[model samples]
Target chain A: MTTPAMMYVHDWRAWQPGRRDTSQPRLSVAEKPAGGHVPAMLRRRLTGIGRALCDMLAELDVDADCPLLYASRHGDGERTLEMLDSLAEEAPLSPARFGLSVHNAIPGVYSIGRGNRRTQQAIAASGDEFAALLVEARGYLAQGEPAVIVAFAEQAIPARFTAHFTTPVDTAAVALRVSLTPAQDAWALTPRPLTSDDTAESRPQPSDLIDWLCGIRDELHCHRPRQAWSLVRAE
Target chain B: MTSELEQELKHLIIDTLELEDVTPEDIDPDEPLFVEGLGLDSIDALELGLALQKRYGIKLEADSDETRHHFRNLRTLAALVEERRTA
Candidate 1:
């Protein structure tokens, strides 16, 4: 018999920087990353998204070597825009800019800076990326990994592409330390395949995870379009 | 005239590249900008190019092989800007 998926969300943190207003479509991030907690060499090289990701990673309670998975709907939109601008202007693209424009750039920098050689994944999905991350985290728990960290950071779409999205996105990141061992007040997550009846209203927000982390919500049912993932408070 | 442009170039490099720890006086006029001397990489070079274009109204040819030679050091960069400045 196969062991059922059992995982405990040990700790989580949320950091949202920049103006809350989504009308202004410019890239804004925290002026300083974790108040310089990140090493200067790495910090200097990091883009705004990378800095935000590192800041969220610093707030995580997990070990430095823990496996990490990062998810986002739009990862490094500013850098990507800059690359496009360079291309349009017929300018040579900088090697460093191209390197940081990749979706996995933040995790790769974190791995190298902390000397972590474990496996890491960068995920990008159309909608409800946070839900996808939770589902992925549960899968990791099923494989007997002691713990995993899922960090997500994304910003508002650039002004050029604002027409493409209906929801006003903001610059935010959430880091969850999902563990195998259940502790007091841990939320147990069980994911089931979704049916047609389950709609978009059940979709999870970044704030929902924050509410669960802060003990405000007893349970959270994070849903994707066709995924019926649910989290319940362990009794 | 050359020394003044070189000094101005040094300050521009420090400001535009965000070399927080280094000062204008710290960068040598003849030191290589990449790999060994000032430790700037290709991104810095691109940013510096843009800044120079904005400040000095200079045009940089991306396909020109001589562009790399101009970016070799602060002195070379200042000379190129001086020679090419339209405004």
Candidate 2:
């Protein structure tokens, strides 16, 4: 079941710095993403990736019970790195930061705040997360659910890794709700696996994925370590 | 009247927990810090404990009744700091 059925894009939101698209309605998440409904206590714990995802998810007006698929290339790396640094220094680590140092911690905290009881999956599939999320979301849609929310977030990399960033929109997120029924746009996908030699070590950025979802691209090619997909606009 | 140490503890609580819009004048010395007046949770309790250890070199036994009593309110917490603080 590599290929999912024809998928429809219901709604989407993208946030980044210096993105002034006059065509769309203005949102307050231009530079700093406010964890819209997240309370102050929990909101302070959100990293840059969590901030973008939270803002986009809240703006989409998604139901609390809806399944969530959070995809990130680097998941909570800051928290992990900070703990590593603390251990290296023989210093005490803050218990709160330790609790939020997992790939799923942001969403886990989110579920607690909203009291949401739904299947939530967090993925760290390098650059292949876009395609990976599509497959997971497609499976959720196949289950007869009206829609599922798919979010891709990338935190700002350190200065040493700035040379590795391919897109200007490195610290940003794009979230979309998808279903089986036709909507403003749709995607016809032919999913295929990529060999280890071709692009296994690639950390392809999410800027292209953002463009493709915003209808800026009629067709797009995406590559992941395990799978690649030829995505064509179906509608 | 709140003691001078209690005033310091209120500021520390706000700064450490990142409690927005709360001020030293707003926190009552006798009010509970968790599940009540301030509505702080267990995580906040752990965070405040760490902050106290780092700032004043005072540590508490984990989940002990004595620890819970000392952490009951800002007034009691300040009392613990006043008695145990080494730095």
Candidate 3:
């Protein structure tokens, strides 16, 4: 049996930034606030990933000062595609879009908004993003952080790139509350090799792992093209 | 400090930029428009150029250093528009 890590799962929350208002044109500016911690002024300036991140963070009610790990397969989905379109057309890219299209823009904005100067990491690892997120959280806990908020958000793959990429139809965010509390259920992580060639078990986004942690399965295995992680839930 | 042309330019900046929570009166005519003043970035400059063309029938040269000077502030923008306005 792999030694169970001391990290405890406190609370988890998920949010869909703009599932409603389907009337809005796709791949354009996002809709108004569907409810989140972000102020109105900031909301107007947020990309889809940023909006989803702030929304789930508000729901989780974690301290702004807690170390944060933001993971995403595609950091700023729509904005990135838009930038590409501008490049093809030989038009000047929007400075605002170019500035916020970076992988860490969401968390960078969050830290600036709350004035939290703690170390915040932004991660992007193709299929093993969830495993990477948890692993980073564990590292923070080992470094003496009382708690860690692992937030993940991603937008749908742009239509032009759908032929080459795999992504969900909507934008979603999930916040996992990983703490050092000894009372709650815990999970053990171990590196394992794939005995089978089944790649279907791998999840594309971080929110999918929430179901496994929510007791949907006692043991879940995550596989990436290069790595595999075994997560065992405690009874 | 609040001339009629400056007030119009301020209104144009606010409307074109979609700057939320900011009013025309909040913009100082002499303050820098891009960096330390209204915090508008390069993208805003493009959008503002287009909006100015549509409203004042004036064309901003993409490669002209004078265009950058005219976009420095509301006062400078108004003067450029006043010098170029045909109607």
Ranking by DockQ: 2, 3, 1
Higher-ranked by DockQ: 1 or 2: 2
Q: lDDT for every model? A: 0.72, 0.75, 0.70
Best by lDDT: 2
Candidate number with the higher lDDT (1 or 3): 1
CAPRI quality of model 2: medium
Writing each residue's lDDT as its tens digit, candidate 2 over A94-133 gives 8888888878887787777676788899998756888788
lDDT of 3 by residue, A89-174 (tens): 98766656676778888787777666667888999886578778877888889888888888876667878889887545456677
For residues B1-87, what per-residue lDDT tens digits would candidate 3 score against the true structure? Answer: 588888888888787677766998778888899878877867678778867777887889865899999998888898898899854
Per-residue lDDT for B1-87 in model 2, tens only?
988888888899999887866888889989999889888888888888899999999988879999999999988898899899999
Q: How well does each candidate superpose onto the true structure, as a TM-score?
A: 0.73, 0.85, 0.71
DockQ of each: 0.23, 0.66, 0.30
Model 2 CA deviation exceeding 4 Å by range: A1-5, A26-29, A160-169, A184-204, A225-235
TM accuracy, model 2: 0.85
**Candidate 1 or 3, higher TM-score?**
1
Each prediction's fraction of true contacts recovered: 0.12, 0.53, 0.24
Location of the lowest summed lDDT over 10 successive residues in candidate 2 chain B: B17-26
